[model samples]
Target: MMADNLMQSPENWTESQVSTWLRTLCVKEQYIKKLFEEEVNGLVLLTLDEDSLMTKIGMKFGPTHMIIQKRNELFNSKQNSQQNAKPTRSKKTKLQQKNNSKSLHCLASSEVPSGQVHARDKCASEESQTPQQPCILTSKENCKPRPFDQEGIDLIYVKHRVLQPESGAFDLISPCHEFKSFAIAAELDRTRLQAKFAKEVLKFATGCMNIRSNGTIHFGVMDSKEDTGYVHGEVVGIPVKDKDIYVDALDDIEKCFSTDKEHARHCVRPPRFIEVMDRESTAKNYVVEVDIVPSVYILKGKVHAVLLPNFNEAANKVQYEKKAILRRVGSKTEPVSDSDLSDFFQRVKERDAQREEAEKTLVLSTPFCQDLGRKLTMLITSGKKFIENDKWFIFITNKFKPDDLSNIEWLLNMKILSVFDFDPDSKISGLCSKYLEHHAANMHSLQSYSKSSDRSIKGFTEKLHLFEQTSWLFCNGRSGFKANETPCDEMTWIKTRMTLLMVYVSLICKHILPKGSLQVIFLLTSPVEKPLLHTFYGFFTEMQGHTDIICICESETNFQRWQSFAEEICGTETVNNFSVVGMKMSHINATMQMIQPVKACAKKHLPVFVKGTCLLETNREEHMASLEILTVAKKHLPVFVKGTCLLETNREEHMASLEILTVNHCDDTSKDFINEEKANIEQQFYRGGRVTWMNFWLAEHKYVGEVIERDAYQDVSKLLMDVLKFPL
Candidate 1:
């Protein structure tokens, strides 16, 4: 009787009721999110299992996805009630088709082109007969959309954005209430865009887990509800496995939009959005097509990883040790600075402060500054750091100019491959196995920074160039883990580990970035938390451009603080204080080797580094490059040293984007030291074939850290008073 009177029916229900209902089921609410409405089919079948079996919970399906799909069916089915209402196409005359071909032939001779055809010739081919196909995939026959594949989903991915943090300031009416296309400006609202993004991320994540439970895989879509309105989210697969079996539709999008993208700053053509807004125009429609796929990162299984230059086969291990631990939320540990993390947030805070500053500074730049406001969107989208360096790990390299290689000593001895075109991990690994005689995870280091004119440093730098294309992923399947919970919820697997590590390292002043380094904050609530805001904003609040990147990202947009930091490091603008993660893995997808060496606590009286021998060599030409690579590695210096190191920065012009610097003070006085050094450097700088180091490292096994018997951490600090070593 209660179901009969109230109107939650699809035809009469509003967005508010739906959003409120969805909130109650999530947050470990016992059952996965579902919806219900029965009168239409008498029994609204909630396709719980892929078998299409129906189970009626109430007047409507209890799950939101089923409810939304039903809503879409009802609306779309009603809208297209009259399938017979078709329009015939205007046939092109044989003479016109022939004339078109003849004109192309005539034009090839560099003659004046044939007279212009009627503008009407550009009408959509649909003006003639057409068969039904997937909607929006193609622009049209007449549009001849420049081979633009209809990645309608690609439109959903927004580029990175600079978030602002201000309590009660710049806060919106909830993103769901205003969420809309961040890419399409004509119909976009800033506050709405951010809200929509938050809602969708949450929805997509929850829906993805739900779908996986039924033993069925899905590609791109889920459903959401918020204060502003309803949203059908873009869903893709999570990598529980290392294959692209699920989310294949996204693959289609990626195919159309080549993965390689540039910032296209100051381009003359209108934003691709302008063309999309003019979707009716054939010429513009051709320009508006794009893929709407999101980049997918999966956390599954125990993958192996190997280090370079040195190794400890038996000591190798991962940062985290269990899958249950990897997935556990709040079942783990606490963050070092929750109050500080929230209060010290920087992305949103800095953005807000900068926006205020920009508002104040606008008068200074006049026309130039005026143009900046519109570019807010552009900067957010394309302002990514140049990280095309392989993914999955931090890859340090010596970025030398094309002509400047080959004179270095290492280059002279090594028969290098095309430095730009080989896999550093594979080549390095193969070389190490065959020639270095060292197993994976057993890399050696030089005893001293400058045993011979710092030439070895230069050689190492040049060789890093050869490794520019190398790929790697970090972690011991036992130790490394990630998750998709809130940044504040450090209790989640990934967050807890990062938080603990950040705290542990930040405790020391030598650490690159200190704890609570951030001073801005932004918190996005799920529709379940704030249904009123989501119901009104609807799809606008569920966009991907506004989503955070540090957590689970279901879209292609790279909108996060880490991405922001990377962009600044890689941007064309001058960087006074260049900072980036220092790790050996980046790109190239190399398997992980255990980080076993530092796992167990060593004798307190003598740090293991004191016992390990240091192997040193010199190559004059690439010495500078080598120093720079070393600087990046310094970030993790204390790890092997129980988190301690003599810190310095690379000031050289050609730092290869990796922050490393070699100690400049060294004496290798062998005869024509200076002259021989320069000549030797010039001789083998190029074609270093750094990949051969895998073999070269075989004979190398050395380690360097202050002797543990003394308090080196404090001693290094006292020594720091003097001019620090050459920040190679």
Candidate 2:
């Protein structure tokens, strides 16, 4: 009645009903009710084992122990009720059962000794922890049971065992014999029997060890309710003479593990074989049970042929000797591959890098009036403070001309800060000519300022070439625009211009500047209004060492907007301060504060730098013809640049367009690289394999935190559509 009631409405069960239901099985009603309210849920109580009921659900030991007993009573009652309702078996059915019993007894009498039956049951119960059943073995004339402790292992003949059903002969083989706890082997090779048994033992042990709660290896047991009964298998019986068979089998197994060179470390622990005896059988034959133990780590190794049960399969199937690198693929254990290992290792490297990065100190450029005042004073009074024999430095400004620098006292003190402006598009050759023009003008300016001798002119001119070569002669973004006539494909042209600027800057820093230089500065006028200025923004972020960006905005709005852009490009909420149109005091003060840290850091570290760039081989017919005209005009530059800007102003519009976006510092660069590369590889500075170590160190630098955004899916799809529409 209880089983029927549960099946009718398992979910409708109540605490009162549970107490009443378990009361008849010697469970006190008060205890059942109290435990039910405290720890047990009426609906799930049937699903939990006694140990889980006590430990997991916080049930009392006495009441939890009676749960299985109450469950058995209900199940047995259901069985008795069903039997009473069913009609008696027909004559044919009775004859079938009788024939099965006779077949089983005959097989048992011929093959298994009376004592062996007891051993088989004992082994089954010990290994599987389940109730044992009678099994019959068909023994030939030579078939004999071997003792577990026999020092010199001998040939032990065996046969397949079939389970005997209630009132039937041994008609049915063991249920899904492949998944059963015991394995039966027929015939014996005298010499290699121990070796063979050792191989077989590891197979079953591996199968049991591989089991997981949510995994597919669901062979032993499955919990079921009245609606869904538990799925369990009967313990399999192995026929052997005595318990000593276990001793000999285990010894050989341990010997195999000790001798194997490749997989010896994976061995968890030694296995033990227990002796079991059948009390009802009047035979000397016994069963030896092999039991594998659990360990802290998962055991993995190659195992010979072993059969393991699969819930998805109809029966247990044979598995060959294969490497056991079980990895979770979806829900099943699949062999791991090289790609998986590579991905795992990459993740580990990234985690270590991130942890190391978190421990470093960071310096922020805070805007303050006092700091600005100090910076302005330093610029004027500390003219020769940066001089060092081993180091070199250079400075360039887009806003200030040579006339503006002539009046500055520091200009006379610092030899590297030649007030001449340079165009990025101008070649190294053009600068070579500009060097002569700049030297003549400087000599005249100095002569008029000091009314000094021609002897001092030689010293000035000696270092004049170094200044001309290193200083900004002409890095005009405007020249790049005039050179590239293609307005329809603006972004591509802009990318070309940015690449030119970056390459030029990189070359100048590497070749022109002194190795281990203290400082380098680039001053820009009205930078935020230009399109794709992230080229400059990204360059500043990537060039982390002692480089300063001084943006001279045309208005307060432009200054505020550029500051916001700096935050995005730098990947920080608070970045280096910039001077506004009417806030000269605050700007200079902040610049001074920023420079203080640079000076301190310069003493301890050298800037990370890359070597020069090799020019690409391409069709430069236009460039070649223009080179002669450019050289004749004394305007040959190191590289060409074609600047372009996005035609949007609204922040939302900029975000929506296919422009590269800024990533916050917290964003994972690997994920960003994956997303960005899939869209546009050229836009991303950290192009993974091309600059892995460079990017890693740069990313770790306190000042460098920004990254470009990945291309939009819509943009990618539209581009693909256009390609398909106009296929070549």
Candidate 3:
């Protein structure tokens, strides 16, 4: 009523006077918000530039462009209104006005110029002047607000091998970029954002997982060319076996993962002919499971995950319809409308109030929980980079969108608690405890957020932690989350879901190199392991021979199992000292125990190394070993008493390298048997390719120096690379 009365009286108020009055009441942030609404581009880069104090403060809508636009609208409107007011003024007044316009012009283009406001400073001050702060809040590790927990990773793969000069794989990926991940990112098209988001919600949020395997297009038949059509399809999983379940699964999977034929080879297969590929490719592939070891493996910035908030579709629909109506009349925040002028400030405030109250109960109660927020954050980061081999390495997560963090899957960060910069300068475990206790709105400590469809971070420890020991086979996407997804009729989603699994396993092989909690030593008896074994024997001898002992054995059982042709390749005497226990041979773990003593003895005098077959199914053997530890017996080997990890590898060079590693594992007190004088061990070569045995069965010895699987033993050649360095 007063505003209307004042407008009518206008006590002789002119347009110039009113415009000036309005300008006095304006704050920088409000003005910037207006500019935000006017800009077409989505991103706003608020950088510092020297020499220009004139940049209107607190408004960065799009790169530097929006700032310029806002400045023009701000001062120009004033100048135009002034020039038209009081027309009878002198020519001198007009000249003064023109000078003011010129001064404003100089300030407008002064980005980065000397004596001008630094671009960074200018943006800061403008933002400072505003009551509401814009969240340029980058997705920093510090800002993650939560840690991940121990849970829900099905297949883990790690690829620690450096790029071999000849591995044709370097060709399939982009060479210009140092090393982009196997996955590629596509820009979100305007129309596709909602669908893309919806799909993510269904797959990750709804617990309906679908991975793309193969994609094909089928055009109309030649005879029915009149009504030509094409069908685009992918592979999907619907934990259920029903027909309707298949259709539903296919739809949900298709809705989320778009198909790409190039990434198709990245999945894990049960068992097949390896005449083409080694098992490590599946093991060292891109990882996709959530677990303690897995936490330390997956590198950030791959297209590996999409977080889905547990939003109820029905509730969201209702809220969307009712929000404006509720806000229209005397609400705490005004002006929320059909216009795109969304209000995050008010929304966040309301959310905070509601979330705070809901969490008050848990925050005060849970005995085990300390800092829920920190635990959630730790869980995510830890799960991303699970430590393997106790290799004494560290992983540093990069801030989102920072160039330095791009494609940097693995890096050597100095191992100091300070580098992590956790508050109180303590280890991660300490910080996590505190954060989960006092900080989480819900004092629920971290369990696993990745495995659940609900927005929960608790109560699934028993089920989610089962990732390490169990393998759930998916038949069209129904791998069994609590509320399994509905399936689809079209088999289109199957290929995609399968493809996702392969990629997941590949990364697991590459990153998820779990520590053999119980280490052991292995003897290579296969003829094929001989050549590589010989090479390693020489390499190790050069460093410290007494540190390790090499063993090679020829078995009558092995010779009879192979066909005559395979037998021709097998020579008995080459693998001389290798040992074998009884035939409970069905158990790979029990067999590995025989080699554990060798490792234990080596560690005592110098260093010891564990051995596995060419198939290096040590991944599976890990479970076997765990079972042995629990069900069989627990032996307390000394700290130096490391055990063997029965790994599978076809490259003889790897065996030779392992021989060198065994020596590398030793110190002054340990004896080494893999050096130059005992070079006879280097003469060994590896053999075997059947499922009946690991990739390598024998390490045949040559009277001469070792002959390896050609070039696979490079890691052995450079003996110093694996050394663990202490931070100064």
Candidate 4:
């Protein structure tokens, strides 16, 4: 019986016989296990070719080819034996009866798995007993169980075949409304795995990471359109030969992310690829489902970004690298925009602030903080005095030609006085004459008086009193030159005005007003022609020591010229007690409001100037000098000073000190930085130690306050006045 069984055809062998034969062929245990799991009997085994062994049975090529070779050899031997002997009718009938009995016995055996009983019974039926019956392995009842469970299989079937556009399911495999965490692709690039398909994979994967969810990408299935204009997903499985390419593409994508140290968390585990059989097709067609896991190590206060290779379509290769931060919006993956990125950072900042608040408690009674409070209080007080009592002399030099009267009118019509809330009719005496001839009598008297011995200190004082009543002095070059006068005459007239102004300031500082008490501001709208550069240079050189001059130039050229003249007068690149700022005429009101009156006493110490958006100090001497100004400004003001003994230290200690000072300062109703109209500013500062820094903007007005050392304080009085006086 054993000899006869060994010589029997492979299709006639039972399940136990087939397993023994595969073992004799040295088939791997895993392959044998797959055969058992699929309930493969002699009939099913004979039907499987090399493609079925690899794709359907999930075996590698080497073992699959080996099994196919053995099966072919068995068929050849059986064919040769059949040709060599013609069976008689009596012998054939008896042989067929024995085979039929063995087939029925095999179907009734307990060793056959449950689902395979149907196939075994069909094989034993009388219809299959014909001598010329062909094997039918493509029958629906003979199909192997799918790798996915019932639920998974149902999902894939719906996605692959259903198209309900009104319910948000579309035929396209693109990002859509139906699926937020699922995507589908038909195939990969045949030539290279990582061309366009790799990018799509990465984008979908990262989009899933940002949305904080796992996602799926089904390859070998695509959205197909019917002639009726309806679209639905179709299971167009990858070709047998190209399946390896698609597998490699998925592997490459996994390797690309796993190797990246920065974004490796996005793929904590390698993607899972499962081969699924096509439900509607009888052919050995299959689709691949890739499962992606969400990122495991997302950082706080940062948006996760992934690096993707930039594919050059024209060159048909990857040319460079780019970074992307993607998030799923509905069904589409979108790169984060600049505004969204900014808002994310802002939220991060606020979150960090909240965390810090929860960690550390702020105390307001520290010595350093008390010192800051005292300084802040003094600044507020001295600032008010400076704005109210200090005398300001604004000298305007208009060098516009006679033909350019429009420029002069523009200057006169500027809201310069309005910036300070000064009424032109009362606070400012006059606009000053446009013509130098209008000031000819005063100029003649000034020239004669300067040369006369009778020009005593008392006489100069009276003259200055009259000049002080006229808070603003306008010098028009157009007026200085007559129609008959040449350009040279105009230059001479300017020089005269410049000289007279300097002499008048010198007299005032020398005898009448206290030295270093007056503030002088120069608004030079018109350019100082090159011809009069030297004369203007000499005038500035003499005026440099007596006053603190702030020159606001309306044009770049004028600013540069004024800056050059200032540098020349000081004999170095650094200019002291002088500042040159350039701006458009339209910004004059805003610029003037930023200009604080420089105290004459602190001129040597305050050598810092603001140029454009930069605040520059010459050296350590200037930095210390500014602190000294603050010290003096505080002393002159009537305010309660506390904690005078705190020692200056590093930033941490300084901040601790400021917290106490802010609390103390906030207690005083008269010295509150925030008023009822600006209550939000108070809340912003008091919430945390946010007011540690010196420079801040309140109600669109900039205020600068600094505490360099225990004894040295910045003159925030001047800055505070400038800030508080500005209209919100």
Clashing pairs in 4: 171-231, 171-232, 364-660, 369-657, 369-661, 436-479, 605-625
Q: Alpha-carbon error at 373 in model 3, in Å? A: 34
Residue-by-residue lDDT tens digits, candidate 4, 1-728: 65466667767787777777776655667778778878888777766766678768776544565466455456545654675675432334333343332211111133234434453355445323223322222211111112211222321121133222212112211222212111212322454444445555667666655544445554444332221111233333443445455455544444445345445344433323333333223343444554444433443344456666555667987643566677666556678787797675466445434434422442333332123223222332233533333443434354433333322332332222101101112112223344221222132122333424577777754664444233233232223323322223443544454465456445544555563444444555555443233334443554455244445554654554444434434433344224444333333322222223443221122223441122223344455664543321111111122212211223325466444333223333342544443455455655543443322433224322322232213465667777878734
lDDT of 1 by residue, 348-443 (tens): 344334434533443432222122211211222233322111211211122222222211221122222111111123223322223232112222
Clashes of 4: 7
Model 2: per-residue Cα lDDT over 276-390, one tens digit each = 2222232223233343322222222222122321122223332234444333232223444666655643454343343234323223334433333333334332444433434
Q: By descending TM-score, how would the candidates be arranged?
A: 4, 2, 1, 3
Tell me the tens digit of each residue's lDDT in model 3 across 1-728.
42442232222444333333233333244443544453322112112221122244333322333344343343344444556885664454343344343212122233223322444455655444434312121111110000122122111111111211111111111110011111111112222333332332222211111111111111110111111111111001011112232123223333233342122112211111011111212211221111011110121111222222222444542111121211111101122344623453335344334323433432333233233222222222343233223322211111121222221112211111111111121112322232223222111101111234452323333343323222122222222234443333323333233344333223222333333221111222222211122222332333232122222122333222211111112222322212221111112231233322332211111112543222323345456664542121222111111222222233534566444322222233222433443333333223322121111211223323333444535865555455534212
Per-residue lDDT, model 4, residue 547, is 40
TM-score of each: 0.19, 0.22, 0.17, 0.24
Clashes of 1: 140
Candidate 3 off by > 4 Å? 1-70, 73-701, 704-728
Error of 1 at 602 (Å): 19
**lDDT scores in order:** 0.23, 0.35, 0.25, 0.41
Which residue window of length 10 is worst by lDDT in model 1?
A: 586-595
Ranking by lDDT: 4, 2, 3, 1
Segments of candidate 1 deviating more than 4 angstroms: 1-44, 48-437, 440-728
Better of 3 and 4 by TM-score: 4
